[model samples]
Target: NPRDYKSYKLLFGNEKFYDRSSNITLNYEYFYSCIDNMNISIDQLMSSIQKLQFMVVNLNSPDDDPQLIFESLNSTGVALTDADKIRNFLLMNENLPEQNKYFQNYWQPLEENTHFEVSKFFRYFLTIKNAQFPKISNVYDEFKTTYNNLDFDKQNLFEDINDFSNTYKMILECNTGTKKIDVILNRFLELNVTVIRPFIMAIINDFVSNKIVEEEAIKIVELVEKYIARRIITKTPSNALNKVIATLYRDFRQFQDKHNNQYKDSEVIIFLLLKKQGSGRVPTDEELIRNFKHNDWYNINSSYRSYIFERLENHNHIESLSIYEGLKNKDYSIEHIMPQKLSSDWKNELGNNYQRIHENYVNSLGNLTITGYNSKYSNRSFQDKQNMEKGFKESHFVNLNKLPARSDKWGEAEIIERTNQLITSALEIWDFPESTIHEMIEEKEMYIYDGNETFSNYKIHGFTFINDEYIPVKTWKGLFVELFKLLAKIDLNPLIECTKIDTKIGFESAIFSEKTDDTE
Candidate 1:
């Protein structure tokens, strides 16, 4: 237990898990299973394994980073995971009593709750605590580098991580216990939106600590739900989600600071989320409608279709199919009313516009549905396909599939009709909650004045210039012009004399006309 993660889990695992991989059975059972597969006697296998040599690495000074030692020994092909390296760094140097104490109190529970995904837990922890995202490949190094410079309480850091990991597991495993929250969590997992975990962890921590009420926590999570779903539905660039989510913990705290911490937690989250514009913006209803009609969503993404069908299928009911459970993800498949690989029968149904129709609707909402019998009755003529078992007519997913089933013939007209029907239902499913959105404050464009102010040369927003670097009456424009004039005697102007302009903030367009001591 005072050793590495493999042994720590075995000793403190309550007989629930075995070495390194956290297998639930005993370590001997695993070795026996390997022996059974190899068809070798246990005695001979033990003899051969005993002959294999291993090295025990020691650090002469506690000042030596175990991380360096790990890298040196890892060349022997027994490399540790990022999770293992982090735990080793955390516990390797601690004294014996505290070592086992932290292991039993924190590390053991972390492994059990996260199902041994301690690396992912650490990633989310770092993202929230650091107010920025870290590369998963160097999680241990980033954590180590940041901590050495940060003025934080070390024991408090460990305890906070211990607490946050509990809620983190709830979010990751979708076992948050509150039905409303779990539904949102499951939807996030279904969409493969793990990037939001760090932000959600902050929210859940606040809720668990009673910094905010349960209602407020649910509202914030729901806002995150809308923010992500709208982006997916509108086919927004996927790269932006990581940056937006990474700094949300930072943004939320800044909001509280600016507002004197008086604003409702939910409102601050909603306002900041709605504040995201350009690529990071939550797509509006009109944009969602346009994107739904024209976007080649099927080709762009397949998971959303299943998510869409699953939600819309149960939209009306008080209780219906749960995608989190085995019902939807397991039983239903993304069925294409018009198959992606074209067939003659489906082509005739499309009529003269077969190529055009198929191209437009191949992966769109109108063409796709969640069905049980996808392979059994795929790409056949509509009447024949509908009459078969698990037909669209009998399909429980109604909004998209049922419309196509009811249509007399499948063609361009039918596809357009079905897309419109889907749009009507989808509007309610991914709708951004109505909020009094804060208007974005525009930057004031104040022209710099160079009239009748005598001053010694000074740094203009940190761009230092000497006394009278330009003519005494000077503004930023004139400052640039004066420098350009001096450099014009050559064909190539490689050396720059003045600092590049600071465009966004604290631009003091100044003058040296008023010369005085302490002129600022």
Candidate 2:
């Protein structure tokens, strides 16, 4: 066997066996050394391999679920992906000719267009249809269920999936061939907001289908950007955003119905997002400005911080400079005008409360600027930083201009003044959407829940709690349970205390006792 070197080479002569990038040669060498060290010759190795038994499975009937059988196999082979299973589920049931047709026409091309991200494609694809995110592990199950529910033939359904996947590919690549749309898409990607993809995909689909024009599509993307940007600036929790965004298309449809289908699609989206209450509300300009003044702009996430400054610096410029590229090439960095670690000259300029001033204003907006030469300005005094080459005085950035002229000294006062100026610029860059609801409102009456309400033949349309928009409810008990659920989420102890029998609070029986079997 050792003498037959040519045959041996032919047997294991695949290029991957020796290719460095493949890492196959390293593993193969180790395996060969182990075989030699164990006194196992080529004959013994071949004999051992021949003795190994593989359990083969075959369905007794053609109707048996190949997907189930494939899943049930316990072979120590490479595990199948959700996309693989879904593909098998769809095609395994068909005849060989049909399978080949579907694979060639739909499945293969879908995978290729998504760059082989069919699993994620299915998850986001179903999220738009189902109005909720399906767990990655449950994607195949979710797909099967939805596929069964819809009155779609295999060809039509595959076409739909392929169509949506094309748009999704555009979003993932950030190359929609439209500069305005692509810019916004890049911003979303930089923000690392994968949650908004389904919503964006739905919007793009509408545009291509002629349901909305290119202008309206761009407007919707901008609206989404404002909603997300304001929330980020205000430090809102993003946990509930998935549900809100996933349901936007559905909500827009409902809004259209209520308005006798007269409102534009963009208007309905704005209405729904603006009407949200609590943590999900589209932050007002006042809130954004207040937060902008106090936010630790330097320590914010790098992407968000860059996005903020880039928007400000290039705002309304005839030719915008690439702040992202400059930062990448080390041509620019976030410069602290007052310097992070103060020099003695800077200390003297800041005065008696220097430590307090440095601690408070060091990372805030006014104290920060982008400079091409950050190392040269390290801990320099106010006048040196202002008057040096490529300094505040020499910089062309709108943010840095007029900063030297603001005052001769850098201190708490100057930072506050600069922050006020930047806040004015920010207001222009990320302005809140103005509401035109009065012109669009119908003559329908709405109700708000109050404690003293009595059920005297009053039919429930919907109710609003605190700042929450109109939430539709069917029965009085549904409203009561929902209110208590919201209260319990805030603090269960308050509700638990109320559940106990207490004459002082005018409770005769336990209202919400867990032990009680009464449905009421």
Highest lDDT against the true fold, candidate: 2
Worst 10 residues of 2 by lDDT: 504-513
For model 2, residues 393-499, the per-residue Cα lDDT tens digits are: 77777655577544688789888988888889888877766666654445343422233334466666567664335677666555667767777788899777766
Kindly report which residue stretches of model 2 are placed more than 4 angstroms away from their true locations once superposed: 1-40, 74-79, 257-261, 387-389, 400-407, 439-520
Tens digit of per-residue lDDT, candidate 1, span 385-427: 5766778778655654677668778777777888887888888
Total backbone collisions, model 1? 7
TM-score of each: 0.73, 0.78
Q: Each candidate: what lDDT?
A: 0.71, 0.77
**Model 2 pairs whose backbones collide:** none
lDDT of 1: 0.71
